[model samples]
Target: MSRPDPVFPFFLDHPARVTSDRLELLTALVNGPRFDPMFRGDLLVVPPDHPVYRWQCRVGGCERPGQHHVELCFQQDREWAEARASGGNQAEFLEAATRRQHAGWSRFPA
Candidate 1:
């Protein structure tokens, strides 16, 4: 059977516009926010229709000042608590959790 398409869609949508390295950079651009400190601890939940969304990032160190990408807010967040409990069902979830209780994202303010 054919494998599923990759998460990076440039190749399928704009094949003539970019090279492989461009794809790599685009992929990084899309996911890089997942590592910045301010975003790591926040929960990401979208409704079924995905409209009327709420986007929150903690206020702290970031290249774009006033926009935080690293934070310590997760320790008190209820979602964090529940996720940790649920994550325990997965193998070695504690060992795999991020320092700020996030999932594998960096904790540094840089």
Candidate 2:
């Protein structure tokens, strides 16, 4: 007959220890140099203008999350659609686009 796994009993008996160890490992990983500093904090706050991870609407002063594939937020995208239909180019739209207020969520420092 085959013997039972030795690790299962240890984990079952020391769940708190397991949890603490996992947290410790996670903390260490987060504090490590390889991890990006932007995501090291308790609250992840990516900058709107980050070169690699652009998270905000492209329109100036807009505070909405960008839609997938499209850089602009819902309102801006709708506005752009309407403007485009009227023969307005993206450059002109960007120049004349009105500043939008922050989304419902509270603002975090970049």
Candidate 3:
């Protein structure tokens, strides 16, 4: 007898060799839908004149399809620090922290 594949075969930590439809279905099931901030292809990595930014997942480097980076706001700069750190996404601290650099979310590489 033949066996069926798992319903959700993709693991976030590992590379998934899944079809686009499968990935779309999974994303829709979970996050419903998300707007692509990288659509503009600007500041995808960071904003201009940013004091300091650290690239996350350095292991993946620029080669990764989706590069994650976050700005490093020092404690002394309370305004900027609080603004960046205010985001409630505890899962990815750096990811949330970097959001403060842009108006909303812009993927434009800068």
Candidate 4:
């Protein structure tokens, strides 16, 4: 039996672009707003079809399928409860995720 190529197209499609250092930043924010103090313990889920879809383009080929990702929204929280109770859309509490690189292109420039 032959081993498969180490770098598969799918795996390369959305390689972990966020740097290890920035991972602390991204995960802290994404995991939950309480994880960080910027958004009042709110959680924003970027829809699978959010406009920032290109951020996940690993090869810059823009060939990945849409089903790969999903948008998440702040589903539960004290503020969310209050706002929803008052009939308000909490769009302002959401943010798009940014990609970062620790080693950067210099380490693997194409």
Best by TM-score: 2
The residue ranges of model 2 lying beyond 4 angstroms of the native Cα positions read 1-35
- C-alpha lDDT score of every prediction, in listed order: 0.40, 0.84, 0.39, 0.40
Ten-residue stretch with the least lDDT total in model 2 = 101-110
Runs in model 1 lying further than 4 Å from the true structure: 1-17, 34-45, 48-110
How do all models score by TM-score?
0.18, 0.60, 0.18, 0.17
Please report the candidate that would top lDDT against the real structure: 2
lDDT per residue as tens, model 2, 1-110: 99997776878968779878889999999899998998877787777778889988888888777786878888889999999999999999988988788777725474
Residue pairs with backbone atoms closer than 3 Å in model 1 (clashes): 36-69, 37-69, 37-70, 38-69, 38-70, 39-69
By TM-score, how accurate is candidate 2? 0.60
Model 2: how far residue 15 lies from native, Å = 22
Worst 10 residues of 3 by lDDT: 57-66
